[model samples]
Target: MIGQRRHFQVAHRPRNDDESILPLINIVFLLLIFFMVAGQLSAVDPFEVEPVESAVDGQPGPDEFMVIVGTEGRLAVNQDETDLEGMARLVAEHLQRHGDAARVRVKADGRAEAVEVVGILERLREAGVERIDLLTVPET
Candidate 1:
C-alpha cells in the first residue's frame, strides 16, 4: 500500500456575494434619494411663534401666501424678516400677482396681542385683500 500511488481530488465552491451586495447597495441608494427629495419644504421662522388654536379649518389654495408675526410683532414674509411696511408690500404684490386666487394666511404667535393682530389685519385690508385667513393649530 505504501508503494502504490493514490490520487486525491478536492472540489471547492467560491464565495459569491457580489450579486446580493449589489442589490442591497442599490436599494440603499434609492432610499437615500427618496428621503432627500421628500424632506419638509416648509421653512421655519427665525423666532419662535406659536400659532393660535382654531376650531375652524379651511383648506388653503395652491398659491397660498403666509406671513409670520413674531411675539414681538416683527413681520416676516416668505421667511424673509422685514418690517410691517415690507410685509404689506409683499402681501399686496402676491395678491396682485395671483389676484383673488391667492389666499393669504397670517401665522401669529399665541402670545401676540389682539391689538397687534388686528393691526395686521387692518393692514391686509388696506392692501386690498378682501379677506385674510389666520393660521392656527387644531387642538388634538
Candidate 2:
C-alpha cells in the first residue's frame, strides 16, 4: 500500500489595518463645524430702514418722528395706525406742541401705493414739517 501524503492548511483572517474612511469623516465634521460658525457670524439684525451710505456720517438726534405706511394704506405714527384726516390732525398737533424742532421720517412698505405716501408727505408739509427723511430698504 502507498503511504498517503499529509498536507497542512493555514486559517485565513481579514486584515484589520484599513483606515481609509477615518480621515474623510474627520474632514467632513470639521467642514460642518466651520460652516456652522461662519453661518452664525454672518447673521445680522433685521433693519426697518436702509440707509444710503454717504460721506456724511452722524447719528440722528432726538425729537424725530417716525411715520409708517402699511401695505393696506394704513398710516401709522411710530406704529400707531391713523386715518388720513387723523394723521393730518396728529401731525398738526405734534407740530404745534413740539414746534419747529421736530424731524419726520417716513417708512412706507414696498407694496404701499405711491399716492398714499405722497398724500402723507403733503400732509406733513402742510403741517409745517421741514426736515423729512424717507426710509427705504436697501437692495440686496
Quick one: best lDDT, which candidate?
A: 1
Q: Which tens-of-lDDT digit does each residue in 6-83 have in candidate 2?
A: 787988887666576788899999999999888874422223422333444344334456777766566667556677
| Ten-residue stretch with the least lDDT total in model 2 | 43-52
Sequence-dependent TM-score of model 2: 0.53
TM-score of model 1 (CA atoms): 0.78
Q: Judge candidate 1 against the unseen true structure and give its global Cα lDDT, from 0 to 1.
A: 0.81
Can you give the TM-score per candidate against the true fold? 0.78, 0.53
lDDT of 1 at 32: 97
Q: What C-alpha lDDT do the candidate models reach, one value each?
A: 0.81, 0.70
Instruction: List residue ranges in candidate 2 displaced over 4 A.
Output: 1-63
